[model samples]
Target: MAFLRPLGDTGLTISALGLGTVKIGRDQGVKYPDAFTIPDDQAVRELLALARELDINLIDTAPAYGRSEERLGQLLTGRQDWVIVSKVGEEFENGKSRFDFTPEHTIASVERSLRRLNTDYLDCVLIHSDGNDLEVLRQGTLEALAELKRKGLIRAIGVSTKTVEGGLETLRRADVAMVTYNLAHDQERPVIDYAAEHGKGILIKKAFASGHLQAGHADPVQASLDRILGTAGVGAVIAGTVNPKHLRENVEKARRAVGDL
Candidate 1:
C-alpha cells in the first residue's frame, strides 16, 4: 500500500501522491511542456475513479484552473471521502489570469469554491500566490482564511509560496505550505526543512518538472519521486495527469519511494 501521512496537525491523512485536476479544466495559458486535449466528463470520471482505487485522497484544484471546481462538483459523488484542496488569490478569464487577495474577496472566494465544489467546507485552501507571496500574506489574505477556519468554513489554511522568505513566513502562521520542488529546481528546499522541524504539512508541486523529465534523462520519474518523498515532513506530491497509465505509474513510484515508512 502507498504511504499515508498526516497533513501537519490538520487531522487530514493524505496519500503520498495527490491528483492535480488542472488538465481536467483549463488548457490555456498553462505551463505544461506539451499541449493536449482536455478530457471529457466521462474520461475525467474514469481518471478520478482510478485515483481513488490507488488510494489517493487529496485532490488539488484552484479557481484559476478553469471549470475545475464546477466539473468536480458535477463529477465527484462522495465528497467526504476525499480531501479537496482549493486555492484563493487567482482567477482565470478570457485566457488571462487575475489575482485578488482582499479579505472580502478571500471570504467570497471560499464561499464560491464551496458552492462550485458542492461542499459545505473545504479541507484545505491555499493562497495562490502571484509570485508576491509576502505581500499576499501581509495584505490580510491569511487573516481572512484564518477567520474562515474559525467559522468552520475551512479546516486547514496555507499558502502556495514562490519565494523562500514567503514560504518560511507561511509556515510560521499557517497549517501547511505548497512549494515547488523537483530534480531540476530545488531552491525552495529550506521551506521543506522548516516544515519538517515545525510539523507543518508540505505539498510539492511540479514534482515531474511539468513534464520536462519526459524528454531527457533515464528514469526521471522514479528519481523525482525518490528525492521528494524520501525527504521528511513531506505530506503529498501533487501530480497532474489526465492519463490513467501515467497516474498508475506515479502511484506505483510513490509507493516504492516511501517504502515501509
Candidate 2:
C-alpha cells in the first residue's frame, strides 16, 4: 500500500497520488479542434481496476470533462471506499459549455452530479471556481455550500481555484482547498504558505503540470515537488495517472520527495 497522508487536521487519510479523469474523457492529443479521444470502456475499466489494486483511493473528476463523471460512476459502482471528489459550475448543453454559479444552478448541478456519479452523496464537492469572482465566492455560493453540507449532500466542501489568492479566500471557509501548485506554476507558494499557517487541509493539483514536468527531466517538476513536500502544511499531491505503472511511479516519487523533509 502507498503512504496515506492526513488531510490537514481532518482525520481523513488519502493516497498521496490521485487519479484524474480528464484525459480519459477529453481528446488525448496536442491539437485543439481534434483532441484525443477516450479509450474503450474495457480499457478504461482496466486502468481503474489497476488504480484500485495499487491503492489509489482518491478519484477526482469533473462534469466539465465530457462524460467523465458518468464513466467514473460506471467504473466505481461496487467500490465505495474511494473518495470521489467532483466539481460543479459548468453546464453542458448541446455539446457546448456554459458557466453558472447561481444558487439554483448549484443545487441542480449537485443533483445532476449525484445522479451521474451514481452515489447518494459526494465525498467532496468543490465549487469549481473557474473565473468565478470574490463576491460569488463570498455570498451566494458560500451559502449554497453551507446548505449542501447541512443537507448531507457532501461530506466536505472544497474549491478548485487557479490563483493562490482565490484559494486562500476559499480556504477561509472550506474544509478543503485544491490548488494548482507545480513546477510550471511555482508562483502559488505564498498561498501554500498561508494555508500551511492556518492549518487548512491542502490538496496539491497540477503537480506534473499536465505532462510537461513528467517529460523525463528533473528540471522543474522534481524541484517543485520537493518544495511542496517541504512546505509547512500541504496535505496530499493529486497527480492523475491512467497508466498503472505510472501511478506506482508517482507514488514512489512522492515518497522520495517527502523522505528528506
TM, every model: 0.97, 0.86
Alpha-carbon deviation at 132 in model 1, angstroms: 1.1
lDDT on C-alpha atoms for all candidate structures: 0.92, 0.73
Segments in model 1 whose C-alpha atoms lie over 4 Å from true places: 214-217
Candidate 1's residue-wise lDDT over 109-200, tens digit each? Answer: 99999999999999999999999888888899999999999999999999999999999999999999999999888999999999989989
Q: What does candidate 2's lDDT look like per residue over 158-206, in tens digits?
A: 6888776777787787777888777567676776777778767788877
Model 2 TM-score, all chains together:
0.86
Best by TM-score: 1
Candidate 2, pairs of clashing residues: 27-36, 28-36
lDDT of 1 at 188: 96
Best by lDDT: 1
